[model samples]
Target chain A: MTQDSRTNSIVINGLNDSAFKVRLNRNLEIIQSVLANPTTVIGLVIVILMLMMALLAPVITEPNMPDPYQMPRDWQAARSAPLTPGHVLGTTNRGGDVYYGVVWGARTSLKLSLIVVCLTVVLGVTIGSIAGIVGGKVDEVLMRIVDVFLSIPELIFALAIAAILGPSFTNIILALVVVFWVKYARIMRAQVIRIKQRDYVDAARIMGDSKIQIYLKDILPNSFSPVMVQATLDMGNIVLVGATLSFIGLSEAGIAEWGVLVSEGQAGISAGRWWASTFPGLMVFLWALAFNLVGDGLRDVLDPRTETKR
Target chain B: MSSADKTILSVKNVKKHFPIKEGVFQKVVGQVHAVDGVNFDIKEGETVGLVGESGCGKTTIGRCVAGLEALTEGNIYFDLPSDKIALLEDSEKQDDKKVSAEQIEEIGNSYDIGKIEGDLFNHYRRNCQMVFQDSFASLSPRQLVSDIVSRPLRVHNVCPENEVIPRTINLLEQVGLGAQHLYRFPHQFSGGQRQRISIARALALDPKLIVLDEPTSALDVSVQAQILNLLHDLQKKRGLAYLFITHNLSVIRHMADKIVVMYLGKVVEAGNTEDIFANPQHPYTKALLAASPDLQSEVTSGMAALDGAIPDPARPPQGCSFRTRCPVAQPECGWEVDDVVRRLEHKDSIFNFLKEVDQSDAFNAKFTFETEAAANQLMAAMKSDDIPDAMKKMVSKLNCDAEHVTVSFKPAKTVPLIACGNGSSARCVLVNK
Candidate 1:
């Protein structure tokens, strides 16, 4: 369909018995387009599978009754190859079931990444909007603080913060949030500065809307699309970074995090038991790839500049 | 025009001056006198047209009345009952200066919108709304038509939550849109449609007064007429008072009951629309009428184009602001050294020969030219017929020597608006004297 007709249909179908239904239809359309792209579909399948594993972690590991967080000591089954009936994807040198580790690893990876991304976005958007909208001296002070944080490289800053706080689940999440929030703050602040000057904002003021009401209802919603796309893409990177910290032992030693699994399996790789490390490593690659593809698909659908091309 | 007519809005000497900031510390350097001592009244069901060239502060005055801009000085009293208005007028008659802010505030039925606070401010906000010029930019792109039109109702709590949508639909229908347009964003519509949507949004609150700021400037001529007619019908139906701000004389001539002609932030002429159009008292008003194509007849030979641009607001010339460009400018039209310099600045050859200027004030200046001939030429130009006869008559002193000329003019006071017969007033020195 031509762009004009699509716009017309959007208008015609926009308001009805419920606004919720209109939003749902828009989301469905975006999903349909994402599915139409073959590469994105592959990514979607991987993402869905990962989500299922994360959600059904206990069920996946319950049949064998292996504790995902414990090291296996059954020497007989320790180095068993892939396709073992009791232990699929083989076993580690310490006899931990790789299948169990991978299944429960999805939960740790997804949870930490989600928590970090959500925290960063919330912190960044609030601070950024306040800074841009308030302007003057307050803006100058906040932006200088942002500059101070931004001047340090992300991995280095996160590492320094993590090292200072000591290895723990919450500390790692904190470090990631501190390092990632600056990116969102910069982008959201720029968007706020541009959007606030638009005449609609003035019109909203004339409509007797308070500043907070205008920000939440008129300004922020319009400025959030790019931030959302950025957040989606950042999710993949956040997981990777979390895993890197875990591999370096910033997290608990025997946790079922994918990076810890990779670190533990590195010892047996030269002994020709590559399946132990390779499977978990493949899972990490697939997780990041899924998020990246989804982010790309979202950009295509949400960004008006690219909508014309589609 | 009658004493029985009710006044919905009375703007008394409204002034809005915006400061110009310079350097990093944002030190105030000067102020732009956007609306300088403007006064007008809109009856409960009357349309008042504010006409001027761009930057004459017509929009600024509208914004002031709509409570969008805080006044620098002056008060906009809203919804004054006739008895209280008479009381206010009696206070004015006693001694306008002694009419205290408390006295002004004590008027039971009137609310001074510019100074009102809290609940009263919100009350005035709900009662007076504005329709902006740029419809596309004025409507939030992310919002649906239903939300945009219903926003005022929602903001003021004008309707129950469930009734908001239906009320919005009714407003859209009034503006010529239908249920099909409710869910659409502003980008989905053309310019004309977008303006209609804006109008619907403004009309949502059932305001007693609506300030329309160049509502039809961005639309096509045909579309302009349609919007004007819609406004006329809506006004008649609702008994709405409109502060219509526009530079388009023909549009105002058709819609306005009272026409106010502003020049450089001051109202130069104001009267009934037909009387002002038929017998314009102010030179600026006459120039504006001549420039309007629809008001001109083929038998009139040629349209009189307004010469020169609007004076800089920060440094507006000392007298009748219109006098600098008024064809009928007189000796008493506040001619100063600034006028001499203004004329010289535009004449390149004479200006290039100028060397130094020593001034005591706006009325006196001594010029040293490049050579004696330049000084002689300057003296001659002051007496030439090209100079307005009024200006020549006011030249109190003109002395020329080898390379210098000193010219002084009789100091003239700025002209104040004076009442002519037939409910018209003009700020012209000729008419005032």
Candidate 2:
């Protein structure tokens, strides 16, 4: 009987080729939907440009050797104005180059957001998976802990933690890491809880797949889109929060950070040396706006309600 | 198409009760008796159709058979040898010659899906698979057709690494889908095509028993026939036993060799399909057959759709569970004080003034009313035509004292499934007589 059925089937040649084509088409469809929105395209372009600027920071401007992140001070160019010869966009009161600050500020912002987002996403997913899967007392206890973390306002919580750890760039990163992870934990827990009940997970269990296999293959992958969207949004949020913390004098003075440069430039605002503050501040606004637009577009595209359409 | 008398799965008085919890401390207030002492057997390569209305515990029984749920009571023996099955049945009968305890223990350790461990449990897992109702939800949205169908083989290492793809394509082909259908997500397929994929996945491991939990319920009628035909062809080729669960009697009549009718977590009737369809002994089964629209039947007004919803499974009525809605209910059909309360609770005027009920047992209870007039109203209601004649006849004692009305019923025992001579059983007083 099996032989008869096999003979009846029209076996196509180049099985792998067809399989590859199907996968490619599915991926292309996802990409097309994600790029359909105009706002998302604008966000994508700005994000790419910002990323390029960050990557080429050292190549675009000579590094301040020994400590590249430390702004180079030139007493001769002190308080220079916009488009001044050899000092475009002028310099701060202490002669920190505005052009250098703007370029390097992207690198700083990217580092802070990427590191915090990565660490927090991993931490949050781990805790949330444990809570959702283990449930019972562990779920109850972990959710209470998450609720405590969520109760406090995000910015103030990051500020207090950074303050307690003392003023430094590393400490601000640590504070943001601590503050941002709880939301991921909350989102992942909810997602895991929802996905674990899906019939495929039950089917996997019925097939005698190991618990870890079910979690990694069935639950995690299905539950990950929302987390992906959250991570993208947090790429913007983490920087905004970190910059705010830095602007409040939590970070060391004169670092090549956007928030520190904005603070330094604010002091000279009354004296008409606006280029110092304006350039780096504009970079911060663009960074946050680009990611926000992209995140909103992603939320619309990857929304679970519409996920089946693809 | 069934093989010689070999039992593939035997569900012996299985019960699954889920706890209803409340409050921060998660207190167990009560239990919903989802599957209460249900028993049936599926022979090798036979289809046992479990037919019931929605929430009749058909799906729960299916889940238990697939080993997806832990049974709160009783055992499900999977792939038990014929000799061991006979011994187990004899032991259950408790005849003069009893099977030894050690032999029973041996059979349980080897055959019971719940008690078996390690290699034996894995063997059971490989042999039993499930195809769920919602095709869209059952197949993983993230998985391609190749991954979904090939998953069981990979999990069980049923074949070598290199042969997984060929074997997957073969499985897909057997389900009427070719290799071109592989590598696509579940969302890309039509409902019937998705169901075909699900069947292909279930067929991957070449399971001995497949639990079809309303597998074609979500498909269009035309698509449903195609899937059912595909299932029949696959079964014929593979010699697979199926626990076919569905509420559609017409579908069951087409697919099942034997049928088990259930009502409120208990089997109301069980027999060969032709016998049950020709002469349904249980009232619920009769009502179901009457309600189903048969094309050959000339009288449309003959439809006897059951009135009243199924009673709460948490507090299932005594005796026959179907007695609440049985048109042919008798005096001995176990009418109790709860029945009186259920009938009169809808009358707001009488119940609003009713304060409490002090009950000694299900058969007896004393009603305390806010006024003597309210107690008289309750007494009048019980004797009125609003109450069934059988229920009124079963009331052994009824009296209205100033502000209290006392009612007592002849205590009825829980009805057991009685054999009716020709390889059939029914849970009804009329059948027993």
Residue-level lDDT of model 2, residues B89-187, one tens digit each, is 888876636788898889989999989999999999989999999998898898889999999999999987767888998999999898778878898
Q: B178-207 in candidate 1: lDDT tens per residue?
A: 887877667778888999999998898888
- Model 2 interface DockQ: 0.54
True contacts kept of each: 0.54, 0.74
lDDT of 2 by residue, A81-159 (tens): 9889978889999999999888888999999999999999999999999999999889999999999999999999999
What is the TM-score of candidate 2?
Answer: 0.96
TM-score of 1: 0.81
Residue B272 of candidate 2: its Cα lDDT?
95
Assess candidate 2 and give its lDDT: 0.90
**What DockQ, between 0 and 1, does each candidate earn?**
0.29, 0.54
Query: TM-score for every candidate vs. truth?
Result: 0.81, 0.96
Question: Residue A66 CA error for candidate 2 (Å)?
Answer: 1.1
By TM-score, the best candidate is: 2
